[model samples]
Structures are given as C-alpha cells and as structure tokens.
Target chain A: MKPPLWQSIGFYILVGVIVLQALFPFYYAILTSLEDGQALFEVNYLPRALNLANYQAMLSGGVFGKQILNSVFVATVVVILSLFLAVTAAYALSRIRFRGRGLLLLTVLSVSMFPQIAVLSGLFEVIRYFGLFNSLWSLVFSYMIFTLPFTVWVLTTFMRNLPIEIEEAAIMDGASSFTIIRRVFLPLMWPAMVTTGLLAFIHAWNEFLFALTFLSTDSQRTVPVAIALISGRSEFEIPWGNIMAASVIVTLPLVALVLVFQRKIVSGLTAGAVKG
Target chain B: MSKTVQKSRLSRSRTRSAWLFLAPMLLTLAIVAAWPLGRTIWFSFTDASLDLMGEARFVGFRNYLEYVAWGDGEGQYYGLLADARWWRSVWNTILFAVVSVSFETVFGLIIALVLNQQFRGRGLVRAAVLIPWAIPTIVSAKMWAWMLHDQFGIINDMLQTIGLIAEPIAWTASPDTAMVAVLMVDIWKTTPFMALLILAGLQMVPGDIYEAAKLDGVPPWRVFRKITLPLIMPAVLVAVVFRALDALRVFDIVYVLTPNTDATRTMSVFARENLFDYDKFAYGSAASTLLFLVIALITITFIMATRMDLEGKRS
Candidate 1:
C-alpha cells in the first residue's frame, strides 16, 4: 500500500527543504558569531575556530541590557493598554445594542490596516504635541492602532461565542448588563484576553518602523531598532561580531518564548490568521 | 433575588458600569486609531512636511496629483503608470506576493501532507518548521543577510564548492538578485505559517473522505485536485489574502536586507522614505493611503469571492 520511491523522495525533499531553509540562517548566524577573530574572514563552510569574544563584548557593552528593557517595557505597556481598551470596546459592542456597532467594528478593523506611513505625520504631530517623542511611550501608544482593533474584534468574537445562559442567569437575578459583563463575561473571556495580550505583546516587541522613526536617542531605542543600528554607526566599519551578538540577544527571548509556550503561541497566531 | 424590588438601583448601576467599561475603548478609538487615520486622509490633501509645518496649507489634491505615476517634483519626470517607479514597485510587489504565496502554498501543502502521515520524528519536524515563523523578522533578515554575504559567507562558498556558480553571488546587494533573495527569505520565514494555517484546515477535513477516495482507487493527484483543494479553498483563500495584504505593506525584512534599492524597494519602504527621509509628510500620506486602498480592494475582493463560494455551496 505504500507509494513508490518517488513519493518518499518527494516527501523527504519537501520536508528537508523546509527545515534546512529555516534553520540554516540561524545556524550560520551562530557560526559567524563564534568564528575566531583571526578566521572571521576565512571563507570556509564551517568556522575555523570558535570565539566567544563577540558575545563577551556584547554582554559587557550594556547596550543589549537597555534594548531588552526597552523591548519588555514597550511590549508590556502596549499589551496592557491594548487589552484594556479592546476589552471594553468588545464588551460594549457585544452586550449593548449600539446603533452603529457594525459600522464601528468595520471602521476600527479597516483603520487598523492602514499603512504606518499614513499615520506617520498625524502621529508625529500627536507625539510631538504631547512632547512624548523619542521615548518608548510614544511607540507604545502608536502601537495601540496596530494592536487594539484586532484585539477588540477578536475579543468580541470570543464573547459572542460564549454560552449565553450564564449572562441570562445573571440578568435574571436583576444584575445589569454592565454587572454581567464585569462578573460573568470578563472571567469567561480571560483565555481570549491572555491570547490577545500575548499577540499584542509579540507584535509590539517585533515592531521596528515606529521604533526607528520615533526613538532617536540611543538609550531609548527598542530591541529591533537597536539591533538594526548596532552593527555600524556613521563613518564606522560594519561590525559583524556586534551585529550577530545583538541579533542573538534580541532573538533569544522570542525563541525561548516559542519553546516554552509553543502550543499556546501557535494557537494564538493561527487563530489570528484564520479568523482574519 | 426576584426582579421587582431591588431592580431599581441595580439597573441604574448596571447602566453606569457599562458606560464605565466602554469609556476606555471609545476614548482610545477616538484618540488613537480613528482620529489618526481620519486626520491622515485630511492631511493628505494639505502641503505638510515634517520640518516645516508652519508652511502647511491646504493644497487640495496636489499630493494626489504628485502621485499620478510620475517622478517630477512638480508633476513627475513624465512617465506612464506602467513604467512609473512606484507603480513598478507595485507590480513587483504583486509578483512577489503571487509567486511567494503560490510556492509557499504548494510547498506547505506538501510538508503538511508529509507531517500528516504517521511518520517517525513528526513532532520534532513540526517544531523545527515552526521555529522560523517564531523568530523575529529583523533577526532572521540579518541572519540571512550575513549568510548571503559576498565574502566570508557559507551560501556562496557552498554553491561555488559544488560548482553551481563560478562567482560569488550578491544576494541582496545586486538589483537583479535582491527581490529574489527577499522572496527566498520570505518563503523561508512564512511557509511554516502557510503550513500551520493549512494544517488547521486539514484537521477540519474528515479522515473518512480520503478513506472513501482510497477505497474508490482514485489517483492521488485527482483526489487532491478535486477533494482536498476544493475542501480547503476557504482556508487557502484566507491565508493567501492575509499574505497578500501583508506582502503589499512589507517593510522590515526588506528594510533590513536591502538598503532601499529601487529594484527591491516596496511601497511601504517608499512611503517611509517620503514621510521620514524626505520629510514630505503629505506626499507620504498619499502614497500610504493608496497602499491602504490597494489592500482594501484586495480584501474586498477576497471577501466577495468567499461569499460567492458560500452562496454557491448553499444553492
């Protein structure tokens, strides 16, 4: 019943291509980061000698420590603000009979998809207006546009999918809709809230354009933007060692998160993709 | 617990709390997403630049006129839509999206099929595939950039060692190879995403259908073409549209990989240049608004197509 040789070959080839392609760059990055200073330019398929100098320097530089803090701070604040905003909006749309609920939902979703460029100027005005330019808070607030709409929409969808009986029972006890949402809906939708929060955190952590545009000071830059500029400054030769070291520093957290919560992360990403 | 006596205060409190719960979202939407976007559209019509906002005045369609597929400062250096650099970027973007998504889908389906089988090391392989999608875009882009370096890189060394090419290939540096390299990196990074989405769809498909097809001795290709594809068209469409919209606005990977070359520049990059680099805020807003329209059009078409499929199924 097994297929012939070609089938197995095709299967392995497909799988091999995927794994090799995905894993090779990371492996190469590691190899590059580890290559001895003397053999850094050695055009060998494998590193001639191992070197921990890059990692040593990167860690001692304190540049990475600040970047990590920036990433965490931005991601945390964005998630908190986004979830706080999205939950309320979702509740209002789900429970209350608003005249323009559908229109508002559509508007929020569509506006969220607008290119960052369109909002760049408007946001610049707002950011500079608030004197919040060149700080992590500016980027976090700007990320609300990116993170809030989807969180609200998805939370609303989750709320709608919940069992109606609990809310009905609460209302039958003469509890107001607001009371029902607070006590009944909030706890029930906690998983969706976590999922939404995780998604928002990852997006904010991964965001680069706003980070690059808004955060001008070296100390204020988030991980991605910091990593982008870490390799070279003006008139300086490109530093591959520092670049690899920084890449690993920034990338390791995400990889560790994926490894620890692979199932949950995958479920969240797939849910966002499938639903959208 | 009855609804008559104590209801007086409860209903009032409930209404007040509902409003309280709603205030944050309404305020955020108004202040952040809705207001910024609506203002962007209005700003697109004015002559606004980042450095000189005091000079900002209503220019009424001048920004749109500037985007009329020309390169002239006043009216563009006389070009047609087909040949306009920005429009060319759009075409290249579409080509990239179409090629990458189609390849990723085929490759993803094949991988999904293999992983779907009761094979050894399946869990490990699935986890391995998901790693790329898990990595942040900047990190992966930098990794690829280093790996594709003209000197001291493994990719060129391997290809040369294997006699694939006589010269070291510049993956992201050269204009000819830049887009291809980006396409490669994108395919590498996103195929898992396609696979994961399709795999979810595959799980929704009953095992019995394939069994029935097997019992009928239908050829594998035909079974796939007729049953698998049609059954999963909904999911495929969803993934494809998502990929397309995202691809249209591709920024970080290209930004990291290439230094804003014309051959590899995407619309998002172009818009970024206008807004940040050139300080042409109004013009940048116009270009990005156009990009949003393009994505919206594609989304609408996708929604319409899916609706058509659903209606056809119902009928």
Candidate 2:
C-alpha cells in the first residue's frame, strides 16, 4: 500500500534534516572562510564579504608547510614499507603451508588491537633511546602498529581469494617464488593492494596523539596537531576564519579520494572490523 | 631416477621459497610489533617510571591485583580498587563507546537507506556527506569546535534564529555539555563511514526479492521488515560491531575537541595522561592492558557470534 501524503512529507523532512545536519559544518566553514577580515564573528548565517585572506594566511603559517610535509612523508613511507612486507607475507600465509601462519596472524591481530596509549610509555622510551623522538621517522615507525596488521590481514584475505591454479601455472613455467610474486601475482593483486594502501595511508595521515606527543616544535608538527593547537596571540580569542580555511584545504584531498574510490575504500576499511 | 631426483629437488626448493617469502614479514613483526607488545605487557607489571626508567622493579600481578577486589587485602596492595579515577575512567569509556556507537549506527542506517535509492544527483550527495569522514579527526574536531563556540558560533546563531534555545551554551567548557559535544563531533565525523559500510551491505542484497514482495501486494513497511531486514541483518550486524569497536577506541576526537576534564576523558585519554603527564608508566601500561583486553574480548565475542568462516566467505 502507498503511504499517505503526510507520511511522505514527514519522511522527506526527516531526511532533509539529516542531510542538512551532515552538510552544515562544511557549509558554515566555507562561508566563514570566504568572508572578509573580522566578518566571521559578525555574521553567522552566511558570508558578508568575499575574500581569500584567511586561506592565504593559513597557507603562510610557518607550521602549515612543515606539518603538511610531515603528514605526507609519514603516510607515504608507512604505505610503501607496510605494503612491501605485507604483499610477500600475505603470499606466504595464503599460498604456502607454513607451520606458524596461524600464530603469526594471531600475533598481528593481537598487536593491532593494542591501544597506542598502552604502548606509548614504552614506545616513548624506545623512541627516545633510539634518538628518533621528535623526528617524522618515529611517527612513521609508530604508525606500523596501526597499519601493518590490517595490511597483512586484508591482503591475505584478498590473496586467498585469487585462483590457486594461476600460481601453479607460474610454478610450472620454472618461475622462482619471488619472481612469480613480483611479475605474475602482483599485477593481479594491484586493486587489493591499492585498497589496503589507501586505508593505511589515511590511518597514518590522521594519526594525532603520537604526532602531538612526539613532536614539540612547529617544525616537526603534523597537520592534525598543528590544526588542533593553533592559538591566537591573546587568551580571549581563536582564529576561526583561518582554522576553517585550513580544515577545508586539508580535507579536500581525502574527500576527493574517498569519492573517487568509494567501493574500494568502504570494503578495505570495514574488512577487518566486520570479520573481527 | 631422474624424475625422482627432480621431484626431491622441487620439494627442497619449495621449502626454501616458503621460508624466503616468510622471512621479511616475520622479522618485522617480531621486532616491530611482537617485541614491543611483549615489552608493554612486561612493563605493566613492573614499577617503572618514564623518567626513572633505569630504576625499574618487577612487581608481578600487582597491576592486575589493583583492579581485582575481594575480601582479601587486594585493595591495599593493588590500589586500583582504592582509586576511584580508574573505575570512573572505565565507566566513562564504556559510556562514550555505547552512546556514540548506538547513535552512529542508527544515523548511519538512515543515511544508507537514503543513498540506496535510485535518484538524481545521488553520487554527488553521497560523496558530499563523506567530507567529514575524509577530514583528519583533529581538523574535523577543530572545525566543529569553532562551529559550537558559545558566543560567535553558527550553531548558536542558527539555534537562536530558530528559537530552539533561550541562551548560548558553553559547549566544550562546561562539564555538562563537554561529553555531549565530543560525542556530537565524533558522530559527525564517523557517521558517513558507517553509512558507506552499511550502504555496501545494502547493495549486496538482491532487489528481486523486494520486487517479488511488491507483486505479492506487500506493503512498503512489511517489505522492509521481512525482506530487507533479514537479508541485510548479517552485514548490518557486522558493520555495527565494527563501529562499536572503533568507538571504544576513540581518543583523537575527544582529546582534540575538549579539555581533559574528568567527565570527558575516555580511558585511553586517562591512560595517556598517566603515562606522559604523570610519569606513571606502569599505571598507564595497566590501563592500556585493560583497554586491549576489552577490545580483544569484543573481537572474540563478535567472531563467535558471527561464526565467520573467512576462508569460505570469499566475497
């Protein structure tokens, strides 16, 4: 039976409210970022003036450039390092009949669940001991604790789904194991590789506590920490226009990536969490 | 004899290949992940201080004993039972997880349902809603913090314009509203992710069943309750469980959005404060151990409940 007209209206209104609620912050931020100097505090519903000073100032901040670089460097390194090991490791767990495959996965899964806070104190000592604290490399190394397990787990999930006969065929061609993985299997598994890579990339980029704790100076800061801690010269104020501009600038890339690869991103992120 | 020799050689090579492939990952895990985890657990039982790391002493079961209350002298020895902060942190952590996850699941399901329909500009809308999820948690939290400021925020302006409130509220500063404010920011940032996951699950269900139900003169609500719910139940449950686990580990959003007030601090935040700010390395490790156990227990329960056969469920 068709619902009454009022019910339809109610449903539409409810959904409209939801979409509006979801979109409101972005709209508000964009509106504020566009306004002329000090106009953000005067008007709240919409922009009163059109200007780009906030964006310019945000880009000009001494912290902004280095923080962006740190985030990019850390996320990129973690992706390369984790994926390099994950691919080979996943092949072993999926293809080879190993004695300790189960134990290894179990260990990874257990380690993955460990709250970073639990490991922070000890990792602090370790990081300082290695003289790597306040360095971007420490953040890269710490992020493996976040990404490596999932890379192996999900890639292993993906690899096991690949046809065993293909590998058998490669073996018949006198291909070395490393050669087979590098040439034959890798090309086929690229999508899954990218899927896991994107997840790992985002995790590293979004990491905050380690970056906040491990880095003290603006030169070493990541974007998230820099964005979180930026204060005005005085206690009575916050820099709203610039903060909004910074958030929008940082978020655009991620939003674009997610929108482009919605299916892969969805599957990659939820894969481990779902089957936990 | 040549054939048999080749076979033996192939088997020997196979063993070598397997070991070679396993070597890099195993070594990394052993050094990077495994040893650190072991070291953390060990450090938890010892009276270790961050600054005074050289003066560590082994105190087996003392950390565990702290939380274990009984008629015995465990309270005096462990001190966890004596300290109300630990218990409060646990309660606060559970509350944050439960409340935020529940809200996210409901809101996500609604959003997923909306996106599942065939309509114009659907792609644009779906992508747009995910903007918050794409932003780093720190950025999103800061963005929301500005939007919720007491005096000059758009939220208060809109609320006042709509006559929803009598006065502006100190969202992050007040203990009364701080947790709720944090939860709101978290919900905003994570709901789209939940929606996307649920949407993925929604798309997997066969539409023919609903079409057939319609031919049978089934009402919309009945079709949804009978056909859609049962079919999508497993995926939805999985998504919800995943979300719950994620929420339980929420630290960044809370830590960034609000001051470390007692009411707003999740267990992870509390543990971090203990470790870094207070120099209580053992205590922080203890808190982390408990948090790990909580997450592990949830994971185990989910696995058992779902009865997942990952090898079989290739899709």
Q: Pick the candidate with the highest TM-score.
A: 2
Candidate 2, residues B1-315, lDDT tens digits: the string is 999999778877876787787788777666556666667778888998877775778988776564545768653445444457888878878888888888988888889888888656677777677777877888878878888888887778778889999899989888899989998998888898888878777888888987898788988888889878788777778777777777777789888788678788888887888877888888787787778778879888866676665443345
In candidate 1, position B301 carries an lDDT of 73
Please state how well chain A of candidate 2 matches the true chain A, as a TM-score.
Answer: 0.93
lDDT of 1 by residue, A1-276 (tens): 888999888777877876777677777777778865656677655566678898888778786788789899989999988887778777776665544556666677676666676576677778887889987789888898889877887787777666667787877777766577689888888788887887788789888888888888888888888777765655235777778877877777777776676666667767766655
List candidate 1 segments past 4 Å from native: A1-13, A43-50, A176-179, A233-236, B1-20, B66-83, B304-315
lDDT of 1 at A223: 83
| Candidate 2 lDDT, A69-97, residue by residue in tens | 87899999999999998898888777776
If you assessed candidate 1 against the hidden native complex, which CAPRI class would it receive?
medium
Two-chain DockQ for model 2? 0.56
